[model samples]
Target: MSGPSQEVVAPKAPQRIVILGATSAIAEAAARLWAANGARIILAGRNEARLNKIAADLKARGASEAIDWPLDFVTADAGAELGKMVDRLGGLDLLLLAYGISGDQGELERNPAAAAKVIATNFSSAAAWSLAAAAVLEKQRRGTLLVIGSVAGDRGRRSNFIYGATKGGLAHLVEGIAHKLAPLGARAVIIKPGFVETPMTAGMANNGPLWAKPDAIAPIIVRAGEKGGPVVYAPTFWRGIMLIVRNLPAAVFDRLNI
Candidate 1:
């Protein structure tokens, strides 16, 4: 005696969207979704060939327009590069920073240079782009700047403490920016995903039920970006997972091998 469930339609996607690390799997997935929704997209990444391919694919999928701008994000010109992206897009409605690296914990423990590289890529470079994007969006008086963080950032783990630490830094940075952007009518949000099965994590054992695919997680990113919240956990379940992890006592948490 139950009626069929009604389908809920999503709001219109951002018109002008800029993805800083467009070559990443999750970012590409989000790009395709946005393209399908008729969003204009600007793809910025290090690999010109990959960026071009994604741009073409987005066009084929229905984007109003799709274009690529190649740049290495870990340079002095990173902020300038972000400025160029905003300019190229004509104006920015949504900006996503999705570049990151999960470094080897043992290697980092033994090498200061390795630790520096991880910090530079996952934290410093991201911060530069976020700041640069914030300046433009704030002046424009509207836009959402979204950064892809990780659940590892909620609590540092022995397995990937360096990566966790960098993400933790990014989480705090976005939190502060989110507060600041409130008055400017712009928004900055941090999205933390847990155990996403991407090329970056291909070496790990990802057979568990908690693991998420790029396609599965992309919609969550779009939803959170559209809603303009301070923080979001992809898959929704990670919110509960991180809540328990964050609340566990040090004595209990330190003993675990997670």
Candidate 2:
């Protein structure tokens, strides 16, 4: 008698991914994970040299193909530029928006120019790229638009309310995008990470139980890109922490130094 019939499983297609602000620590870490899975990646950022270096490293780490494109997110015409990128890539699987700036809180408070720059980088530019990616995903009727948000957005704090406001605004924006994509079989996710030890937060006093490394946060990002809810908190505990922070009585909140 012959053996029982065997089943043949087809190989999965490699992911085509684009990472805006590809030089950021957390973004780079997430790209590494995707690369190991044989993803074809395009890195967009202002630093041509750094992007090239990261691309080479990704290729070395097992990416099917990795390339770099230098882009200045603040001044670019996001919709037009993103259309060009999508065309070049032939298709899209995920678009990760990871660029941001954290101006000194004291300087931002006193310097209108500095504050404006922060708002432009963190909110206005980020939103534009997000919407552009959402359009691409909608048209394809698949894929995910994953944006890097921060736990700082959960509530206004005396220390970094300006930055917090940008993130908070971004959270709401992504919520709407998520709703729009759901029926179309697409997805948009906002990743809210707590204190991550990246170059952006290098100057801050970071020793604490709450702080997390980019490598530790990267896996959550990779999973979310594949399949995720509208809003996710990396390290998971931040969700509870933010819940407590968001609901605290204003009278008591006002007295505490955050």
Candidate 3:
């Protein structure tokens, strides 16, 4: 009776995701979006109470499963902890490194210890975790490692050069990892967002049009994980903005107060 047979396609399977620095506003927002897709997620952070609360919220939001793993990002043995998490999850589809600190530029300039802490948290610790996750993804020959970077990293400015430097370093690191994973069918993505309205930036003057909410940036992060990336600028406009800044002459750039 039928003239021709139609092909039937199966629905895509749910993703397995891990969010380090799960308590951060941006990470939480992204996790929420993933949860709605029936993803299985793990929330890893130093604050157990907050992680538990977030895990419960994600579950309520329709995540297939949500597990909280308390972890101190700075001092933890990244390789060992990541291996354990991979085992617990049975495998990994995506790992998001979202932990970072934007220390007071003035304080960082004055106190070496303060600057050190910022460097350690934003660059050293983040890089360690990234490498661990990269290794896992490489071994599996699949998955994505997504890291949150900042637009400030596009060019070093007087206002937040320390933080900017760390982000710039992270961008380069992710680029290398991306290259390494390319042959293996794995991916590493770095998301650079500008002036996000998160708890971290609450104290800063962020009411301007350029400032964006964490929720607004979360979708871009999720898309990058699902698709592919080495570098992504949230809102997409920042790429143009940064291109201009990065190409500015040193003499002209030094005169302006950014």
Q: How many backbone clashes does candidate 2 have?
A: 0
Show model 3 residue runs off by greater than 4 Å. 1-14
Taking all chains together, the TM-score of candidate 2 against the true structure is 0.94
Candidate closer to the true structure by TM-score (higher is better), 1 or 2: 2
Q: State TM-scores per candidate.
A: 0.93, 0.94, 0.94
CA lDDT scores, all candidates in order: 0.90, 0.92, 0.92
| Preferred candidate (lDDT higher): 1 or 3 | 3
Q: Rank the candidates by lDDT, best first.
A: 2, 3, 1
10 residues in a row with least lDDT, candidate 3: 6-15
Clashing pairs in 3: none
Which pairs clash inside model 2? none
Model 2 regions more than 4 Å off: 1-14
Per-residue C-alpha lDDT of model 1 across residues 1-258, encoded as one tens digit per residue: 999999998755688998988999999999998999899998888999999999999999999999888878898576677777777778999999999888789999999999999999999999988888888888999889999999899988899899999999999999999899989888899999988889999999999999999999999898888785798998889999899999999999999998
lDDT for model 1 comes to 0.90
Writing each residue's lDDT as its tens digit, candidate 2 over 1-258 gives 999999977534338999999999999999999999999999999999999999999999999889899999999999999988888788899999998999888899999999999999999999999999999999999999999999999999999999999999999999999999999999999999999999999999999999999999999998888766799999899999999999999999999899
Q: How many Å off is the CA of 10 in candidate 1?
A: 8.2
